[model samples]
Target chain A: MNKSDNNFLGRWLANDLSEKEKKEFENTPEYLAYKDILKGVDKFERPVFDIEANLQKQKEYNQTYLKNVSKGSKVIKLRPWLYAAAAVFLVLIGLRTVFFNTTTINTNFAETKTWTLPDNSIVTLNAKSTIEYNDRSFTNDRSITLDGEAFFDVAKGSQFTVKTKNGAIKVLGTEFNVYSRNTTIEVQCYEGKVSVNNGKNQAILTPGKGVTSIDKSALNSVEIKESEPGWMQQKSTFNQVSLGRLIAELERQYDITIEKGDVDTDRLFSGFFTHTDLNTALKTCFEPMNINYIFKSSKTIELKNR
Target chain B: MPEQQVSVCDESIYDQLYREHAEKICYYLYYKYGDMEKAQDIVQDSFAKLWMNCSKIIFGAAKSFLYKIANNASINEAIHQKTVLKYKSTPQKTYTNESPEFQMEEKEFMDKLNQAISGLKEGQREVFLLNRIEKKTYKEIAEMLGISVKAVEKRMHLALVTLRKKIGKI
Candidate 1:
């Protein structure tokens, strides 16, 4: 009689009526008619359908769809500007691959690195040092460009060459140390022979022999009985190395920037400092030289004359 | 429009939706045209269209999209069949392994039911078939037909009343 009753009757025909409503509606004439219609429609059978065959057709359609997707992405034509940008990017990448085949290894802060080259030649790089070389041509050329200090144990094969801005060290197959920094070059031959070249001057060095070239003019060779450099064993050793150079090495090992205030950094320092502890490293470097040092900030250290 | 870009429905979800609705859609199409094989083809094509526009159509809206496409396609097929002007034979009775008397009663009941349904108005028949055969809810039918739920209930009530009157005579 009402809208809700009418909806109830509709739901009854749909079999959507609840149990109570269904029970109440069962006695009504409309419910009986709905039941009769339901019986009639229930006998209407569904045409037999092969669901498996339908799914198979869907699978086949999806296979072609995947093929079209892959083919679609293959030839995405961009705008002319995008094409030009892509072309330029590709050329830059090609240039990097061809000309800049150079691999440069750098150590920062208190970090030390020991790398075995492709030829099995071992090179231990001290803190703040860098060594660059063309690995692709290393087998044939066995050469490396060096900055700062590195101890090398060259593998026996061809001529091993270490080039620096200050000088060049040429050897056959040997264990040696080369320290090259601004205006100062030092080469120490530990196990084998080394030929050092600084401008027109050249010096041949044998075991326990070290050479120092200052400003491309003064060439001094000294005797060192030690088997390997101290820095290689986590200690910094210098035979008459300058305070400025030692401070620079300290900055690299501990990731600090150092500033000198009224301290003569050019003065020579001859001592060994441990690489592990920052406080101990600073004490060993400055105590003997009588230079006072303090932390300016977390990342800075200032050194002043006592 | 901006919201549709975020819900990029991947193919796996699309496949899931396909498996879930394909059977009901096939049945709905078959009920509309009374041709099972032609209905299957239309359902397949409609699902293919859904896949082609999968990225643009959000996953939640996909069911309505599928039905819309199938409905349009079925309409076109009906028009095309009408132009051909070829008379189609009534669906043949399938063989059942029951007794002869039982089969005779079933066939008689089925004939009467078909007659009752064929006598219905097109609107009422469609609403009834979607509700009973395809098993769509009244809400879903209303949504598909762009009518209110009350309209769906009214159509169903009228269709049932007409079927009762027609089949009661037999």
Candidate 2:
């Protein structure tokens, strides 16, 4: 038999070879090797499998665990799949627990609240502000979303990102204050370094450096002279900002309503207002803009152009 | 009288199928994985699995069903371990006149042959061992392995070719 014939050995093993063919094939050294190998292998004995013992074991297994797995119930056949499904469900719930635990802190009107983040960082939220952070994965990835304004004293660790409406600030470990209101985002870095992105422009700030992105114009750089934000010192400072924006900040801080009667609120006013006294606060806020304010009641004010 | 629908749920039919397929399935796993104890455990587990679903299976299909269960059970254990195949040696008559050199050569050749079989590829080894050791027909091996008779034939041919090359090297 020729080696090229793939079926030759198969046919030979099946005893399908003619006697003459077998005789010719047996003359080759290849045939002798296979014959010896087969002879040696056929003497090997397999381990005995005791059917009675195994059957008895299976019967006992069926009695205990199989629940008789037949006409009464199909639980046995369906159990592995159910367990698999249950495992998947538990895995999803586990993932949800780790990823979906969002902790939110909110401050009411005229209320300043200090919150401790999960990573031991501190966030002092200004009045009428909200901060949301993921509590579960805070250690590995430090990030939070802010609305309104807040002062963050970040702990030393990975890059901490403060996401806001108009811009975002990223820093390793630094004290920075972020304020997002209307179309402006202001970032003041008091220590370490920070990278500020206003979607349209990006800037890097060191200690005592600040950037304010108003509308779509270039970022306005300002010097932060205070060791902390002025609001933290019972005072709020504004730089070339509109009067209407000051009115909004005043209302938020004092929990009062203000009415502007025929006053061009777009006029810029640069000044500081104290939080200690309402009369001084309103006078300091509206006097420089040449706008007159009269307290209609304890919680309401009307501003008139002088 | 109702016509008989040969159900494997019947004790007699179950026993009959078990008797027929249990040994073949055990040896099938043994040849595939080279683990006798694991093969025996797999056989027992496959039989238990079969018993659990006995009421839903027909009698004629029980053989293939057992083979399929046995095959599925061995999927995670296809790692071929180097388990030396042991053969039963006939008691030698000490008075025989064969030379000691010839006897030592025979022992060496047998050891090489066993090693060669163990070193064959999983597919070729299984087919070769099942046929050579179990004396199962090519048709039976084809059905058990879920392949065509032609495929089994080609496997046997290639297996023999490989064995020749391996043993001939010495």
Q: lDDT per residue, candidate 2, A1-306, as tens digits?
A: 775899789889899899999999889866667778777776666667788776667667656546644556745466778989999999999988888988899998888999988889999999999999888767678989999999999999999999998888999999999999888899999999999998888999999999988884688899988899989987889988888888899989989999988999898889899887889998888776778888899898988888
lDDT string for model 1 (A187-268, tens) is 9999878999998689999999999988998679888978999888888788888888888888777788888988987899
Model 1 docking tier (incorrect/acceptable/medium/high): incorrect
Please tell me what DockQ candidate 2 reaches: 0.41
True contacts kept of 2: 0.66
Q: Please identify model 2 stretches exceeding 4 Å from their true place.
A: A18-20, A64-306, B1-5, B79-95
TM-score for chain A as predicted in candidate 2? 0.68
RMSD, each candidate, Å?
Answer: 20.0, 15.6
Top candidate (lDDT): 2
> lDDT per residue, candidate 2, B1-170, as tens digits?
23257777777777777777777788777787777788877887777777778887777677888888887778856544555555445456769788999889877887777777777777887888888878889998898788999899999999888888888886
For model 1, residues B23-55, the per-residue Cα lDDT tens digits are: 878876666566677878888888777777767
The 10 consecutive residues of candidate 1 chain B with the worst lDDT sum are B82-91
